[model samples]
Target: MPETIWWKTGTVYQVYPRSFQDTNGDGVGDLPGITARLEHLAWLGVDAVWISPFYRSPMADFGYDVADYRAVDPLFGTLEDFDALIAEAHRRKLKVILDFVPNHSSIAHPWFVESRASRENPKRDWYLWRDPAPDGGPPNNWLSNFGGPAWTRDEASGQYYYHAFLAEQPDLNWRNPEVRAAMHDVLRFWLERGVDGFRVDVIWHLIKDEGFRDNPQNPDFAPHQPGINRFSQVYSCDRPEVIEVISGMRAVLREFGERVLIGEIYLPVERLVTYYGPDLEAADLPFNFQLLETPWQADAVAALVAEYEAALPEGGWPNWVLGNHDRPRIAARVGDAQARVAAMLLLTLRGTPTLYYGDEIGLGHVPIPPDRVQDPWERNEPGHGRDPVRTPMQWDDSRHAGFSAVEPWLPQTEDAERRNVDAMRDDSRSILTLYRRLLSLRRDHPALSVGGWRSVPLPPSLATEVFAYERFEGDETLRILLNFGSAERSIPLEDDAAKQETWSVLLSTRPGRAGEATGNVLHLSPDEGVVLRAHPSS
Candidate 1:
């Protein structure tokens, strides 16, 4: 591994601001609160902090439905507060990346307000709008992610507006040259504000089918409609024109040296790679969500890792995310023990790893009572709720889990005392300790950051329960072994294996067992994992 900037050497901590920490008695996390906790993040050894939307929004989809891209939402803090946060984060040697939602804007946005004011308004073409059908219905048969129709008839203009998400978040008409320029200005505004980079929201959705054709019905329709299933998105998103738009964004970031542009693309490996563009001029790293979407099988996980590595464009960086504000926490996905195993995989993988804020403490989802749910998606679709993962972060066992001095806007987990950061920080065997060790190892070892990865094939019997891979740089090589099943497993090693003699255990799920290696036969308990460095046998 060679010396590189903070992005290549350290982990990224993603903070869902509204739920991270509340400084005022407002019961919502704000920039000042984040500024105060920079030391805690610094102690965890992360090089960057990816703050989810704090931009002015209608709160229809939290901050995703942006009302103003350049201003911080009053609910979160003021522009001055955001500036303070950026200064504080940089002082602590942490880069700040904001969540840039470019695909859509809140219907209440001034641009949209004027756009809907009249069909002939200069801004009218800034959003996707179509004339109603012969029956006075939506233009086409498209569905929003939140269920129901993706189009809403605007009685004001006798036309229908397209919305890929919530009705209030009308999809931006990226086809319009003016719309593109305006969105780029939004990027320039933040870059000038000393922000490090952006985690682009729904980068692939920046373009849509020009014809507004009805999406082909899914071949396999389950209880969920084809429109809700991924198949429908083939025509609706990841369009070829999106690559050019991404390139324009890349050009914006290149103007600012080393500024990152990460895309949130949920397509297959083949299509997802295109987000990097034909000549690698698109997004720097299209967020690899394989871990979040893949099953917990060892063989399956191993295959996906290998495929993703091979698919990355030349000079394009790779990034992985285990949990996010929008999805279920990894702990709930794989159970407690496996969550630790997944952590080892995330940190040791040959790329930048992003850790969701509460994940380090092994935080589980809080069961949100119906009345307490705030997500419009859940409110619109009663049974399919996203409230569990969006619960307030638990900091201490105090009232409201220390996330707020008053009752939290979102429900706090019931077991906050047992799972809060304070309790875990002091426990040697705690998940928090494991996270610290893993991140520190990456920070200290150059090999872990820029090494070449090679899949170490395990025997069929061992492969079913254990996923193993090796990353090497020059004479140094590190082997990562993870047991994904509920059983102990071992694999035979070559007699003169790389790093056979001096190879030491770098990290392990079991407490106090890191930095020690025994022999050729590596043993891992159920849902256990280890990172080992090979020492050459002299």
Candidate 2:
């Protein structure tokens, strides 16, 4: 039998620190707030919590622009508060993974501050900087992901610095051995603090092409798309040298045994899998966001899952992400009913699953009033703001949804009055209940966790709307059936199992479906998902 790995099989729950919970009535969540809410995660049955950035920062791009890697931001708490968070999480048998932003640092960081001081400063080469073009324009045609030219001129020094996101966040020169060493120490600092692992932010952007070339224009660029899409980012991101940097980070985690490295790479599956490196030396799990990008159709999703499964390197574990701090919620993307199916699909899949905070309770996008907007991207590129999905978590119907005594930094969903953890916990058929059941099932069954996965072929009549797959290990076999369409459909299992054998419904999105017996043909309600346990008919 293969050795069981915690990160490979455990489920991950992402907590957007600023919005998760607030204990000090400061209108923002703190580390102590997270420690207080650990019971909710433990009761929900998740194996780990991946907390987003809480590092000391200037808040230009929120905590992603780090001013200090080792110190916890005062807005969140102190270093002692972080230590307490991990210690308490470990006490609850839940692992804690921190968001590690290595690609860039806040312009306020001492390192960047020193580097931008002067052209002849010893730290001048620590960040990407160049002289103006002959036309006195920015250094290159490379565009920032947050819109505008990637280069921000240092008015005092007359040199331009590059940033992939906000100008307040400067891209570090990964080619600099000192920078690499410094970032490596950052990992060691957390690992030594007993952090279970790290979710490396924008990991693919760690290294830029050495030639400092202009990114080619994207032929498919549209007027409505974000300006970054104007260029293909060929020379700006996912450079080959980034793999070596990933391996170095992986080596640091290796020094602290049993630690995991999860990289956030926004690329196609074929390109995404390469970060695993030869023999899996890079990220332990390069996050798989296919579910977030694919069309909400059975056929499209089926193909995506198959493509991702095929693209994984040998022995590389697979993972699925339904939502995150950066993307729209699943409920908003596919509607409430389909979001239930998404939960089933995520937890029942063969590898690790990351549950975005508030997703378990069916939180959707909340309309943000212009005056309340906090995300800098919205100010930079109107319409591309992620503030709607990064709102405060809905814990109850209390004022501020019980997240804080005062108003939160962001607004809560309009339906938070009834759609909250406290309310959902009392309702048997709530999306939150469905999530807990799915997670509980994963915990009780190896076939659902560290099992083998195979797609089940469906007949042409049901092929476009219904997706089915099997998870099996030893004598345990479970079949998952999902109906992505709005219309009810029936599918037969003749191709999957013997026609005479009956399958027992282990769990279903719809109430009263469990414990029911179904034969070769299974009837499914619209936008419903079911898990069936197969055994020989006595």
Candidate 3:
């Protein structure tokens, strides 16, 4: 068999370490916990596992605020534990992608501590620092994504440091060559240890507008939007210079051949495509967040998909995401019935699919009581908490949903007792079963995995509720139909010759319904999705 480049034609499952599993009875998940769970990933048949940050931190912004890049926090485990995880995952034929936070470092990081020690320190320029405006306010009108101002005054150093997130995460000055070189060394540290790739966090925010210009007020700002949206981020983020920084990081990956680089970027499709770099020299996959932010409507999502496909730069691959540690679960956003269709769409889409940890078992938003809230963003911003979505994974019906022996650091999903891996494993109608079937189909059929794609047009009456597409390689064409509405919809094959071609149901999101339709016009149930292959012409 020829060597296969898995990143281009495989799915990734995102594992938030602190919530994955706990083996030490410390109410927190650890590296050893992840190693023990590798078998589950292999069973699911994912190509790679993307582990979110597990580095040393002050727990201010969780692991996103990295204090030490090379060491795993004792709360997680020792370096030996991480090496064991890598070995186990590889032994099971799974690639490991580590979360890399190069945009910022925790205030407690030795580099940040040294940089803030004095104005004349050699490391002073490693972080962004500026004097306050004449009125003794922030140097600019920058805002944090979490909430409030992005700049915090440092009394000891008499300067205000800028952060794209919490003040605990000080933005690194990538313009400083020393800062760039230091981050490169961090990447090397892990690559030398046999890590496969990196999911770079907030990569678009690496370089800001050099002049420190005040962000202009947004004409469309609304009270319902987050405070960070009060001003457009033109000056504060997604700067043109950031691509050069991305290219430099890509060069480092080249040093370790076959290692992929996935960037966490939230810019517009046009701007997002630029990060691919000329000749595809930037990120191997700049994460596509369109599905996460777009309105959950059939026509709206269909247009977004086609638009994204049209915008891809030559030789650049596409990726998709519905939820992650930062966003709400899809089941909560689209309801349970529609989540099934989403599963079909994600698995059959024309690019890499990233599955959030608990999404497979239909985990929804779990409320976090005031005292149990661990996310600092939630503590600082009352209504905008992410703690609800970062709950523990539900493994069984045991206490804490079998994620830990004691209460978890955060709450598990409200229905985890009934909806968990153990409960769904044996049920053919469960969402987990649908996911397993979809993954298996993708593995068995090339038309569904690496085939060419074309959008199948629907009548105007069914346009808003239905999305139809087809993928074909040679004579094999797989037609996919999804109903986003609550009412059933019937779709007729458009072409006369193609319509006459007999078809068989390969799978359906609705269980016990496969192999039911054998006619030209396919009947679809409410919130249903199905995949069919045209029989060879006799």
Question: Which candidate number would show the highest TM-score if scored against the true structure?
Answer: 2
| Superior by TM-score: candidate 1 or candidate 3 | 3
Compared to the true structure, candidate 2 yields what TM-score? 0.98
The positional error of residue 193 in candidate 3, measured at the CA in angstroms, is 1.0
Report how far residue 129 has shifted in candidate 2, in Å.
Answer: 0.9
> Best by lDDT, which number?
2
**How would you encode candidate 1's per-residue C-alpha lDDT over 1-538 as one tens digit per residue?**
1237556666789998988889889988888989988898998889999999998987988899999888988898899999899899999889999999989999889999999999999998999989988898988887888888999988877999999999999999988989889888988999999989999998888899999888877767776533377346666788899989988888988888888888998888888887888778788778888889899889999999889989887776778899998788999999899899989999888889999988999887678877787878777776667778877778788888888899988887678888888888888899999999888888667678878788887788998889988887887788888999998887665534553465578888987777676577777777889888887777
Q: Is candidate 1 or candidate 3 better by lDDT?
A: 3
| Whole-model lDDT per candidate | 0.85, 0.91, 0.89
Tell me which of candidates 1 and 2 scores higher on lDDT.
2
Clashes by residue pair, model 1 = 499-534, 499-535, 503-535, 505-515
True lDDT of residue 46, candidate 2: 95
* Tens-digit lDDT track of model 2 for 283-304: 9999999898899999999999
TM-score of candidate 1 against the unseen true structure: 0.96
Q: Which portions of model 3 show Cα errors greater than 4 Å?
A: 1-4, 494-500
Ranking by TM-score: 2, 3, 1
Positional deviation of residue 169's Cα in model 2 after best superposition, in angstroms: 0.4
